[model samples]
Target chain A: MDLLLILFETGFWAATVRMATPLLFGTLGELICERAGVLNLGIEGIMAAGCMAGWTWVYFGGDLWTGVLFAAFVGACFGLLHAIFTVHLGLSQHVTGLGITMLGAALSSFVFRMLLPNITTPPKIIPFAPVKIPVLSDIPVVGEILFRQSPMTMLALVAVVAVAYVLKKTPAGLALCMTGENPSAVESQGLSVFAIRTTAVVIGSAFMAVGGAFLTLSAFDAFYIGMVNGRGWICIALVVFASWNPGKALVGTLIFAAFDALQMRVQQQTAVALPYQFYLMMPYIFSIVALIVMSRRSAYPKALLVPFRKGER
Target chain B: MRLEPRAHTSMAMTILVPVGAAALALMSCSVLILWAGASPFLALTLLVKGSLGSVFALSETLTRTIPLIFTGLAAAVAFRAKLWNIGAEGQFYLGACAATWLGTGAIDLPPPLLIPLLFAAGAIAGGLWLLGPTLLKTRLAVDEVVTTLLLNFVVLLFVNWLVFGPWKDPMAMGWPQAEPVVDAALLPPLVAKTRLHGGLLIAVFAAVLFWVVMKYTTWGYEIRAVGNNQAGATFAGIPIDRVVIRTALLSGGIAGCAGVSELLGVKGYLTLDLSPGFGYSGIVVAMLAGLHPLGVLLSALFIAALSIGADSMSRALNISNYIADIATAISLLAVLAGMMLTRYRIRFR
Candidate 1:
């Protein structure tokens, strides 16, 4: 019933992974964008759009995987819109990103309401089912914590590995890093920095949308206004805590999710005297602490928010 | 397409671009109107008429514009100095809470004295709220964007805790809201029945004051200097950190004022839905105004009109009021691109 006891529960870590799946997708998505020198402030709205897109797709008689893909596609379109402004037009990243967030969030909600204006209760969809990783899920407590989850969670795990592998060991990723560090150098290398940053933002946005889709398509059954809440912003902070590294992002996400999941369970404890709102505040408070802790050491991409103009530099 | 800086921006381009951009944005959104089974033209008519057709409608839009102006000024000020204070929404709430705490039977004074005192308290609360994020950015190189944004959630949840717990009004039959402020603390109504109140004067005064300060003052010069080119400002002996911190306080104070204005002038009590994303929409207003202080006033009204109009349009057409949000966002982005077009010419090769 105490906080410590809640941390030891197998259910706690399992929920932690489920929660982390979205943060992981978001953090990794943000990580990818920041790594390539573009800050996708559109994560929140992109996730919202993804949530609606995936739910609508599933609601309209599509398979879950394809629904996720549709969500990613919706996310990618927004990413493309963001890229057109920030990446290509070289507009202010902060303002442009915020604009995209608004567009994504509002448009999705508008579409949702337009689709179901009269439904008093939000319609639910049958979501992705839990799938155990055959051998891995059969092991000790660790297996139960890490392997038995919805397919979306497994995709999140695979995404982290794929992101790490590509970022650390691929030609494309090297170009991305180069773009973030010294775009002039990247341009001199006969590569299009615009294309690279655009791709990163698009892919990162897609990942963020998938992270959002995981919520409605797996964790929960219906999309609600503000359900994504501040998860996307928290991931933005996690990116800082992780120092823009994919592997570290995974660790950071789990820690965040563990704290998040623990707060939920702790809130249920009758002995706890604090209001539940304080428990809800745990993730945001943790984000700020994480930011303060990592601020000094966090080495952000040099050109992260810097605009790239061809031949000008 | 590649872009090249224009040697001189023509006045016509400056005027045409924003108009063209807004038109394009609205045109793009007609698809949604059509899908909603309403004519885009009719929806547009409903929107304009709902927001501005009558004195009553105009008063309502003006009521909504008050907070937008305060929040818009907050964003315009901070963004001018290169501080990204996205937590205006949170600061607004904190301001509201601070005002509520003091105004709800805790303090009573004559209207002339009490209103100013509450505004001052709210500004201080909002300013102090942003101090942490600003200091982090200046001292430790933390990004203000994420920290400020995260704090917004924390502040809201804190408010949620307050309304549902200690601050819950026992007199209000089962509503999760604070006790209403003393009558003396409330802003005098400008109209008999409409929500319009003296907040309009304060908001307009604030806007004009900001415009003058930003355009003429030495501190304003420092803020603009630091924002335009930090390294150059550093070379010129401007204290970049101090300016940024000062900007944070002022920006946050303005946003905080929005909370007090809403709490006193309109709602008369603190509730979870007091500002209704006024902080986020403030960014849109600031952007639409091209970060100009006086421009914020115009843009706030413009945005208020859009929202007010959309509300009526949605009610009539069975559409969503979120369309107005879509319109504002589209305009922000389009204007961003349009502003760039004035400075740079795009050529496809």
Candidate 2:
């Protein structure tokens, strides 16, 4: 009975919130970008840039919110760079995204080394305190799991709803969808496809940056090299798994997060003595399997990877 | 916008285009240096000297080039078939794992047999690793690019798990690494004292073999046809799906060889961060090489030189080694833009 209690309290559900935070931020950001028809493969780089930028800013006496904003700004900058290459210069999105990622990785490492010169210890920061809801504080497990969390969690939920509203309900959202689906048709209807896409990419990148910042400011307080790890790529996969829906993205992110959390929680008790590498492989393995299965049933945007050209369908 | 049949001028222009693009790339790097308050000329000179002037630096550059060559060939092969296999890094790690596992206890043959068997194991492991993504892509119309990239993370985590868990060096204090391979398993030195090893030969041999197969084989011809125009190839009765799978598997296999080389030749043991983005760098090399085997060879060397030089420049100038990366990005952009110019003349409206 005690062991069962430990399993219940320490299993997947208990670890979901912590694991889900980064994925939530990343997937939501990627969802927005993909819906806008700009597949930003540079999400990994953007996230890394955000991680370093957020960590650096927060470490140097800056407010956590300020660090988040700075990370978003950095992501926006990368988005702009991506936009210039893909939209303006008409470069291949894959190549441009890879280049941006390389640049981001190099820049992150360089800046981290330059700013945080030779410290034996990883720098620590006071992370965001989990906020308990006044009315729900007394409630059992559900309330504690749902309500007692950092502001970022609530913000992620709000962002998802807002994104769903913007993509499905608003006129601008309609135009954005039209641009992604058929830019020439949208243009014929007097909409600016380039403007829509550029804005989407920038805003989408900002979300990714914020997500990266959350990883640093809320999840771990310090940044390590490759700290964003594969979260950025995971976000990209989530976009596909969600079938380009923000709400679906949330579900996918949560599921993935739960798995990750379970892996962490069960590390001590699992008698299989499987290498931690096997555990680390779980999320990625799940993601690929999820993508393969989902792609069979999911409906991707019609013009997902196609670059739009003016006066050409 | 149709080109006139001016064959001679076009040929001459094609020959000179890369040179012009290189010049433009240099200018861009110089501008970046100026932004950093450094002299471009001095930086360029130092970069050149740092990469090639010293024997140690030259060997290091070659060492870096070894894995890149395999990854570049891997990307080039897959891209030629329009397969979009983006998990070469993951495949490389898998290959290394297989090689390590085999070298550890599975094989106890002589040096020649053991080494070749290890390479074969690495290749098979890499090929198997990509099988699922290829199947998903061909059978279900799923994008291999996304799946492959995701698998990379999974492979990386697997490496981490190994280093931190079962494979953790029993003798080491706390470092996440496996026990060093037996002396007989280590790659023989190429130049006796220098860091250079026989891995460079393997990379070159792979490139040559790929070039021959791509140029001569009927399968290669079909792959190129499908990549160029799937509908046309299908109409012409080419087995498009089969070709795609074959190319993807071959690419994965080649990338796997890179893992073996790195493990046996350079690193000698697996670690979490074994690759300093060699898989990613392969994308740049493949692109810069225009997906040609010969081009991949040259581009890999140039990239290796730049990476080596970047480190040296850092030591000499106290500037960040990342300047080399910035240089690579600018060069890639310039070269890509130059290729575009060769195909289409841009006209402002």
Candidate 3:
């Protein structure tokens, strides 16, 4: 009865959907990059940059929606930097990505310190409020779980459908997949591998940033250092579990978020007097388990981590 | 413009490229300095003065480089084998835990016996920490990057649990930390008045040893072969799995040594903030060294001075000490370009 009471609660499912929003963005972003045969290790830092960019925009008196766009733009700039090295110069994607992560996180931290030298606590902004859908909100439990949410969550759902549709149906999607699977084949088709891959990385990085922005702009009031807190890394694991499909990514993210939400509930409700750190470690431990469980069955991009030179055989 | 293959990079280019990249990094930092309302020129002088102005400053910088050398070698060794051990931070913490567990009243012994025992225990613990991920990668086709990175959060939480729950120092009025290591376990001071310790000798020795092993040994040759092309290395009769597992042990062990080096030499106990991202910084150091063992020595020193210099610069300017991190990140990015230039030349039509 107790378990049923907790499971049937609408608030828990709402929290699950709320937590899934950022991860959906991140998993989709990573799915885009990996589909184009690039492993963006920079997702963690790009999200951090997004968190800062969106919050800083709002903190400096910009409106919420523009803050989201600005975060995407900033994410794109870092993407350009990543693309220049990994796509253009053909450096090791691992090192380049880790460097980008450091740069993004450090730059945001530096800018934050400069902007607010004297404040002890992080400055708060008017975060995105949950907006109710008229007809849908009146419906039963599913309506509360899905319809009554932040606009960013709706945008994330739209992105998932859009990404899934584009990847499955569009001409551009075919080119992107070819660029990942076999760049030489794509090149022979008279399309520039460089162009397609760069676009995917840049666009993918933007989604990652939006995922980050959702945290500060919608999920929480202000940015704190390390607040991204390995969500980016977990999203990478989720993408693996999703097997590179946007729809599956949405499903995987929701499931993971449910577990995360459930853990928080259990930690709060349990009277066993457990240390909170163990509960905090669960997400990471779950991701490692997820990777092992799902890694074998997934079909990876063929040219992943391989640099495609212009004319080398 | 396009990149064209260079038949061979000249001797001058090899030396000039990294130097130019480092200078480019410095020039970019000047912009940040200007943004912080300080003159870049004076800041540069102060950075130099702060990092190398006196014997004390030099010792502090050297003391900082000690752990970097171990972690740098850790990353360099694993990266050479294409192991992708991003969990050096986690391994470093676990290593510190081992030192804490054994060195803190588990068994009391003289300095000569206790110090080596602690270092050995730390290395084994660190190696075992990575062994699990490496096994998962080798056996199950799982990607180690994600697992290793995620483990950092896991290990940090574990450390939090230990310090706050079981290992709490009751003497310190509830500030969560483990008990200090016995005095016999303490590293002999390298300089009387400074924080510098004899662990610098161990680190330098480790670097020299790594240089020899990486450059000359047949095992080293196998590591390079596997990293260059795993398919080729497998075809050439290399046991891919064994080499990876072996490299994991060595790499993780080195990173673990860094933790012990910090615990025994500097802090003398385990705490939450034992490292200010030394494990992550090791990746920066290794890449900047181009994953060369001897190069790790100089690059570690450079990174050490840069951060220490920034700390000093922050005192004079209104800027935060994070400027050094920005500068280091820029230099690493620049190094990527410099790395490419060494292998190719740009052509415009």
Candidate 4:
């Protein structure tokens, strides 16, 4: 009973928000890519690259925001590479994404070693402080958990709203959806399917990069080798779990985040005899269950993973 | 630009595309070398020398090639069936865990029987690890890519739990590793002086067996038909679901052999870092080999040499060993790009 009370505390919610912030960013990004009929498996390496890029920029005396911009820029370039392979060259999406992942990971580690060689202790930067909203901070539980959070958390929420609006209400969104569902239809309608997909992939990757930047620049002070770990992969699973709906993605990400937050707290607050790895495995297990439950009859984009050439079947 | 499909691809084109792709990858990677302030010529030389220059280097390269062969074949078999078994890493760990369990248990069996039993245990465990994803893919219409990738993390944790919790070595001070297997369980060295083990022979035998199965068997024909066109295969009376399950079982089983080879042939104990992305690297090998069983052997050896060479180049040139990874990724992308270009000739509008 005491543990249940601790689990519902404002601090626990705050941790949940922190854990969910990166996933939200990555989930939103991958959602856009998948909705546009391209499964960007490069998210793992792109997120890792962005995390390292953001940290390196900040370490070189750039502001946190500028560091984030650099990460987005790096991510966009990688997205372009993915677009060239999957769209222009008509290669296998699975292999292309995996190759991009391998490339991004190798480049990030290589650049990091060259820049920071042989440091016994890893260098740290000042992470983002929680910014309390003026009136919102006055609310009891919600204010403490939601208002008193990193700037990235607020931006992520705004991104969800923005993505939902753009995908639902805009002409570009309709065109993007059409491109994913049937490229021939979109091409017949005189919109360049390739161009729309390229734009979606680039913008989506930028969002993913920001999620990664949040980890290094706001959530944590320094970048570690496995910092991005499988979070990017989790985002991929989240796309299927959420059925590619931006609003549902927000809810799904938080559920996964709550699991993560609970595990972190349980490891700290109780003398539970369970292996710590079990805690680490919880979110993945939950996501897998979510996928199994949600993937069937999910109505994925029709042309997903199909390469579109002008008149080819 | 417009691309025109060629009715027939020539024999020369088949050999030339991969070589040209490799050369292009090397040329592109040289830019990174230049950025790192190293001579590309010297780095290339050191890479070749380190990988193939001496008998010891050659032996080490072949030793590394052993696990890769099993994994490469694993990917090759699955990719040919278009099943996309990407959980080789996790399956490898499960195989290693099973081998460790059987080898360390107090059975006191004879060497010949013990070794084959360990191999079977490894293969069975790997196949079982993939069973969940296979069922989901076959029955629920779930995407295997996410499920398989997720299983890798789950099994990795399971392996970690085994080593850190129940299987922690009693003698090691603080390392998270399993106890060493009995001597009778270890694979005997094939060469007298070198580290080469009987595992190489098994890998080669498996490769030949895989080639024969893929080439001559009716099951292989069904697998190819399903891969080329699923609906067509079903219309032609092929049991698509059964083929998928059997292929996954074989794929996972082959990957599991890689784990057993590593344990009984090389490490003799389970550790967290046993596989350095062999499962993932196997994908690259299978793709490079065009998913051919025989070709996987050559590609695996080539990749193994590149990795071994990269280690030496890193030490000699004071560059990060990840340069090899960059080169490898470029090679994969280049190969895909080459294959695309080779299939159709581009013409200006």
lDDT of each: 0.91, 0.81, 0.92, 0.88
The candidate maximizing lDDT is: 3
Better of 1 and 2 by TM-score: 1
**Per-candidate fnat, comma-separated:** 0.99, 0.64, 0.89, 0.86
The candidate 3 chain A region of ten consecutive residues with least summed lDDT is A1-10
Model 1 Cα lDDT, one tens digit per residue, A266-311: 6776666787888888899899899899988888899988898876
Task: Give me the candidate number with maximum TM-score.
Answer: 3
Ranking by lDDT: 3, 1, 4, 2
Candidate 1 vs candidate 2, lDDT winner: 1
lDDT of 4 by residue, A1-313 (tens): 6568867788888888888999999999999998888999999889989999999999999998889899999999999999988887678898898889889888898888888888767799997888999999889999998898999899899999999999989999988888889999999999988899999999888889889989999988988877888888899989988889999999999988988888777787778768899988888888889889997758899999998888887
What TM-score would each prediction reach against the true structure? 0.98, 0.91, 0.99, 0.98
Please report the TM-score between candidate 3 and the true structure.
0.99
DockQ for every model comes to 0.91, 0.52, 0.88, 0.83
Q: Can you write out model 2's per-residue Cα lDDT over A1-313, one digit (the tens) per residue?
A: 4335544663345358667777887887777777777788888888989988998888898998888899999999999888766765566777777777777777787778767666777889998888887988557776767777788777787888999999999999888888778778888888777788888888888888888888888888788887887888888878888998988888898888877776766666677767666777787788877887788888777776677766554
Task: Write model 2 residue lDDT over B129-221, tens digit each, in one string.
Answer: 898889988898777878899888888887887888888888878999977666667788897678788989988998998898889999879
Better of 2 and 4 by DockQ: 4
- Supply the DockQ value of model 4: 0.83
Model 1 residue A38 lDDT score: 95
